[model samples]
Target: MSRDRQRLLDYLVHILEAIARIERYVDDLDEVGFLTDELTQDAVIRNLEIIGEASNNIDKYYPEFSAQHDHVPFASAYEMRNALAHGYFRVDLEVVWKTLEKDLPELGLSVDKLIRQLMDENSGL
Candidate 1:
């Protein structure tokens, strides 16, 4: 694998790990109840930051791959990451909750598919 591809794979691994952590943390909580706990909120936000960061790396290190997966929203993830990492008060917990509850599962699936695609490409090479 190219070094950039390997680094992209590393970032993807982090993204997947973060997604799994968020899943485990929020599996039992409802939306209203989810943001009420400080620990869960922090955990979720941190994982979100990780996802955004990974998305950014994928865009940077593997531009063609990122461009191919236009549905993944790499730019939006960077925007979200910037919000989470820089502007604490700007974060709408409800939005965060909604994202976790709705968007994350689909994101996970997309990212997993991306990993498989990369791996398949590497194997062929």
Candidate 2:
């Protein structure tokens, strides 16, 4: 694979894997019950940070590709990461949970589509 494509693919995989981990961590727990424990919350938050960082990396490294596929909220993820990383004490956990539960599924699908597009485009290059 080309270096550029590899970089993009790495970010995509990081996001998908992070989502998988988040799902696994919250697999049996509902939102109301899940936040009581700190371990799971911390794990999920770290994974979310990973996702946001990966999204930020993609935006910086491949702006054209990112702009072409704007359905995914890469900027929001980055902003979330910024908030979590920079404002750790002030983050709204409810918002994080809601976003993970709702927004992530659609984002995952979009990431998959972007990966496929990257693979198809890079295969010819």
Candidate 3:
């Protein structure tokens, strides 16, 4: 495998790990519970930053891959990361909760699928 492909895989793995961490952090919490818990909110936001950083790295280092996998929301991930990391004062818990409930699962699945596809293509499986 090329070094770039390996790096891409690494970024994908990072995103998956972040997604899992976010899921675990919010396990049984409802929106209200998540809103009330500063610790969990911080944890979730940190993982989200990780996801955004990884996505940004992938988009930067592998434009072709990012272009091909248009469904993965690579741009959105990084944009959200900027918002969460740099604009924390303006962060809305309700929007964050909605993203957690609706977007993360789909993003996780999309990333997982891309990782598997890359592995399969490389291994001839």
lDDT of each: 0.88, 0.87, 0.94
Report each candidate's C-alpha RMSD, comma-separated, in the order given: 1.5, 1.7, 0.8
| lDDT of candidate 3 at residue 46, scale 0 to 100 | 93
Each candidate's TM vs. the true structure? Answer: 0.92, 0.92, 0.97
TM-score of predicted structure 1? 0.92
Tens-place lDDT digits, model 3, residues 65-119: 8998898899999999999999867888889999999999999999999999999
Clash pairs detected, candidate 3: none
lDDT of 2 at 40: 88
Ranking of candidates on lDDT, top first: 3, 1, 2
lDDT of 2: 0.87
| Greater-TM-score candidate between 1 and 3 | 3
What residue pairs clash in candidate 1, if any at all?
A: none
Q: What TM-score would candidate 3 get against the native?
A: 0.97
Over the stretch 20-98, how does candidate 1's per-residue lDDT look in tens digits? 9999999999987787888899888999999998899888878897888889987787788899989877779998988
lDDT per residue (tens digit) for residues 11-39 in model 2: 99899899889888998989887778689
The weakest ten consecutive residues by lDDT in model 2 span: 116-125
